[model samples]
Target: MMYVFLGKNVAQNRELAQMLTQFQLEFELLTYDDIDETILNFCMAHTNDCFDLLTDRLQDYRSRSDISYSELCQLILSDVEKHIKFPLVIKDDVVYAGLTNAEARSLLLPKKVRFMLSRQYLSKSYHVMMARKKVS
Candidate 1:
């Protein structure tokens, strides 16, 4: 769905572009000058949401440098997780296809989903824990 071409020279980059002209892949041209604070913020917020923000934003960064996309994604995840503490286990592994709600249920069964919130009232909820499967 996404193709990244990071070349050291104009000729090489252009050749890659020409080859991909018909594939209908989403393509972006990135250089050192392309990044700004807005791009950094976008990367941070979206990375927290899906963990693919680096893949979406740093394709060329990895290509131009020695790093691979997987490494970049890991680095981004590490940096983001440092700032937040939540009760659920977070993972950055790529799921070939997106997980459906049923699949998520199956995966989390026998496991508990925990929340850190603590409040006295129903609306403000004290911590919540989702215990796995139960027999009737």
Candidate 2:
């Protein structure tokens, strides 16, 4: 599965990328500047209810200036860097945005456990034997 990650080229995004890599998850990273209208529109279409939260968060930017909410929304869509929350991950029709470390870990743990179990099975390791014993 191909995952889409939208964020700036910052430490948080970098960490997210690294975590994905560590889990051997395939993904594409799109920085805020790299997003265009087409991609934004697609995201909006596929985001379902998540778009509401995104728009609500975008409203926060309006408070920073005198621009009307509509104008601010337009500006944010045009230049997402101004309003984007980092480390947004889209995979398998689900969206994960601004995840805390615990959240990320919980999301990844299943895959990690599967990978580890596969490796242990292939190696026929003592750990695997012990695990089987515990299961029995």
Tens digits of per-residue lDDT, candidate 2, 1-136, equal: 6454556556776676677688777677666666666655555566664344263556555347676545644766775764555555566666666566557756744676667757876788777888999999
Q: Which ranges of candidate 1 are over 4 A from the true structure? A: 1-19, 49-136
Clashes of each: 0, 0
- Clash pairs, candidate 1, are none
> What are the lDDT figures for the candidates, one per model?
0.36, 0.61
lDDT of 1 by residue, 1-136 (tens): 3323132445644554554453333445444233334443444444434333333443456346677645554554555323121111112322211223344334422332212211233334322322222321
Summing lDDT over every window of 10 consecutive residues in candidate 2, give the lowest-scoring window.
48-57
Best by TM-score: 2
What is the RMSD of candidate 2? 6.7
